[model samples]
Target: MTDDAMLTSKHALVTGGGTGIGLAIARALANEGAKVTITGRGQDVLDAVSGAGIHGAAMDVRDEASVNDTVANAISARGPVQICVPNAGIAEGHSVHKTNLSFWRNIMATNLDGAFLTIKACLPGMRDTDWGRVIAISSIAGLRGLPGAAAYSASKHGLIGLIRSLSEEYMGQPYTFNALCPGYVDTPIVDRNQDTIAQRTGMTKENARQLMIDANRHKRLIDADEVAAAALWLVGPGSHSINGQAIQIAGGQTA
Candidate 1:
């Protein structure tokens, strides 16, 4: 089938979809003729940004019951979710030693446990369907040690593990599992993090911004649309052969 034909009847769900990369992906899929559901804890943001068949739902991915219910509700309205993007996560750094129980658990709950539940809840429906995709949004830190972000790195690494294992379990199926590792996307998350970066590095706000810019090998902040495009490609016709892979959208630094 053609790429466009493959995506025409799909239902895609993007977690943390109120804004930033998640919203970008949701809209992109909807544009490609898929029913897209954007989930976030903030109903206001979701409502403000939704359009056409891009629906919004309030969901807290950290809660297991909420994850299950949200997935069930989405399926009830739009049939099975053929594309599941577990993008809801909290990204911040605390040294493993300095990370308290709440801090550590919070990261694990949203990043790791949330991904597990999101994928798990969606799988039964996917198994009943003919084709599906599970794409987890991870980070460059998931592949390597982040000096001050041990907890975040560990959580992301766990997400990667989840995708890898699922890919193996359904090896011969039409479903594929993958991870998107992005570095320093231009988003609200970065805006909130700039202050922390400035305070920690004793640098001006602009300098803190430059630090992240230079971290990307291409010397620019990744556009949210760029990541969305990669996701679109994965769910398209030619990408069925790609599975259990990390498609790094961080210019070249992640390679």
Candidate 2:
């Protein structure tokens, strides 16, 4: 798709847009002239970054009533959502034996159930529009197992399944559902995880960081903009042929 053919005069909604990958994707969509609504749990961060064609709303994707109300409000304010990006998630590593039901449910609530509710609420608005894109942000672990992260992996895997089935359901329709499985990205989450890794593996901070970097197989953390570019392509013109695919951004990971 050409620059001019990208999302212009269209409405888009991105969850967890306060920072990291979601913010990058929201900015990219906004740059293409889409009236993008970026949702997050932080009002200050959302307000700090939102401007131009971007609007920020405080939304906790875990709550069904909140998701329903927020989507309704966003649609009423900016028209129907043509592009829905379910990018909000919690990434962490917890041993299965040590993980409790609450821990597991919390992960599922935010990663799996959150994506489910966000897509479900946005579908009505998206279906009403002439064109639509539903992109779920899953992890590379969604495609395979990650040690000590059983719950997280399962949640991401479930998200991919949801997107794939939805894409098939709307195969002939104007809506297209897809998943972006990015490896490690340079985000605040990574910074936090470094501490976790250091504690778990008894490695120095630098060594812990290197461990994740090496895990990417490309031996580098991804830039959030790279993932944003993929989202732009899927919504851009001539991308109708792409659907129901888990587009992995993990560089050459043999895992």
Candidate 3:
């Protein structure tokens, strides 16, 4: 089959698909002829990207009811979700001594719990299909302990653990579970973090941004499309054996 028709008649659901890495992955799947459903907390944000083979649904991944209802609606409208991308998450830096209970919970709720709820809601539909892909957008922090962002790192690490476990649970099945761990991808989250890091460290925004770029071995910020390309590959043909792997999209080796 042609690249454009590879995913024809398939359905994809991507959370936080309004912007950044999520948006990139959603667009790639749509371009491959999948009926894509993009969800986020803001209806306006989702609506802005709806069309051209993509649909929009307003749903908060942190809420179980919202995830359940939104996934059901998407399945009803476009058929089973053969491609599930739980790309909704928040990135924040907080030292353990300064991290309050609410702050840690908030990070887990959005990053870890959000992915769990989204995957859980999408799994039933995926199981009904002969083939399915679960691509969880994790971070480099998931592999290594990121100083000054204990809670954020923990949440991401938890995501990798969840993906690994699910991969074993569905072993021999037609579905695969994997996590994409990227370092400092150019996204709205990174843009916001630049300001936050500058304020926290009393450094210039340029210097703060440079710190992130320096973290990657390549000394440059990664493009969101680079991560999107990996997601597209995971869902494409010949990826059936690539399961339970933490594929790092960082500029180079993280450790």
Q: lDDT of each structure?
A: 0.89, 0.91, 0.93
Mind giving the per-residue lDDT tens digits that candidate 2 earns over 1-255?
245746777899999998999999999999888999999988899999999888999999999998999999999999998899999999987999999999999999999999999999988887776788999999898999899999999999999999989988988998899999999999999999999999888999999988889999789999999999999999987998899999899888544
What residue runs in model 2 are displaced by over 4 Å at the alpha carbon?
1-5, 253-255
- Looking at model 1, report the run of 10 residues with the lowest lDDT sum: 1-10
Models 1 onward score TM values of 0.96, 0.97, 0.98
lDDT tens string, model 1, 82-170?
Answer: 89999999989977788899999999999999889888988888899999999999988788777788899999888888899999999
Query: Which is the leading candidate under lDDT?
Result: 3
Error of 1 at 39 (Å): 0.7
- Candidate 3 C-alpha lDDT tens digits along 121-228: 989988887999999999999999999999999999999999999999999999999999999999989889999999998999999999999999899999999999
In model 3, where is the ten-residue run with the lowest total lDDT?
Answer: 1-10
The parts of candidate 3 lying over 4 Å away from their true place are 1-4
Task: Return model 2's CA RMSD, one decimal.
Answer: 1.7
**Models sorted by TM-score, best on top:** 3, 2, 1
For candidate 2, which ten residues in a row score worst on lDDT? 1-10
